[model samples]
Target: MFYRHDNWRVGLNFKNLFDKKYYESQGDWIRSGAPFTVLGTVSVEF
Candidate 1:
């Protein structure tokens, strides 16, 4: 979800809500998994 104003904005987000196992492969290395994550942000533009 997101919101915007004349000079300000706010937003919220969630990643891996279910805490599912997510894997990332880099070269020959593999990441196990990532847990659920939540994020929020605020911004202002002049």
Candidate 2:
């Protein structure tokens, strides 16, 4: 188990932010980054 700061937190979250799809036909057409990626950020003040 792990514990992190439990203070006022301001955060931003994104899930499946990008709806990218890859098909076998386009096997080599995939981008360097993964599809349906997520991005988040958190800030806290004690």
Candidate 3:
């Protein structure tokens, strides 16, 4: 979700909303993905 107003801005983001478990494999290497995460931001013009 995101919002903006008169030279100002706000935003929110989500990576894994369900918090599920998963893995990745490349060649002979194995890795795991991230869990539930959230991000927010705010900005303004000069």
Candidate 3 wrong stretches, greater than 4 Å: 25-29
Give the Cα lDDT of each candidate: 0.89, 0.53, 0.92
Model 3, 1-46: lDDT tens digits are 8899999999999987999999879999989988989999999998
The prediction achieving the highest TM-score against the true structure is 1
Models sorted by lDDT, best on top? 3, 1, 2
Tens-place lDDT per residue, model 2, 1-46, is 1234777455555544666555433655745444675555666666
For residue 40, model 1's alpha carbon misses the true position, in angstroms, by 0.6
Least lDDT summed over 10 consecutive residues: which range in candidate 1? 30-39
Q: List the residue pairs that clash in candidate 3.
A: none
Q: How many steric clashes between backbone atoms does each model show?
A: 0, 0, 0
lDDT for 30 (candidate 3) = 88
Q: Which model, 2 or 3, shows the larger lDDT?
A: 3
The residue ranges of model 2 lying beyond 4 angstroms of the native Cα positions read 1-9, 13-16, 21-31
- Please name the candidate that would achieve the greatest lDDT relative to the true structure: 3
Q: Which of candidates 1 and 3 reaches a greater TM-score?
A: 1
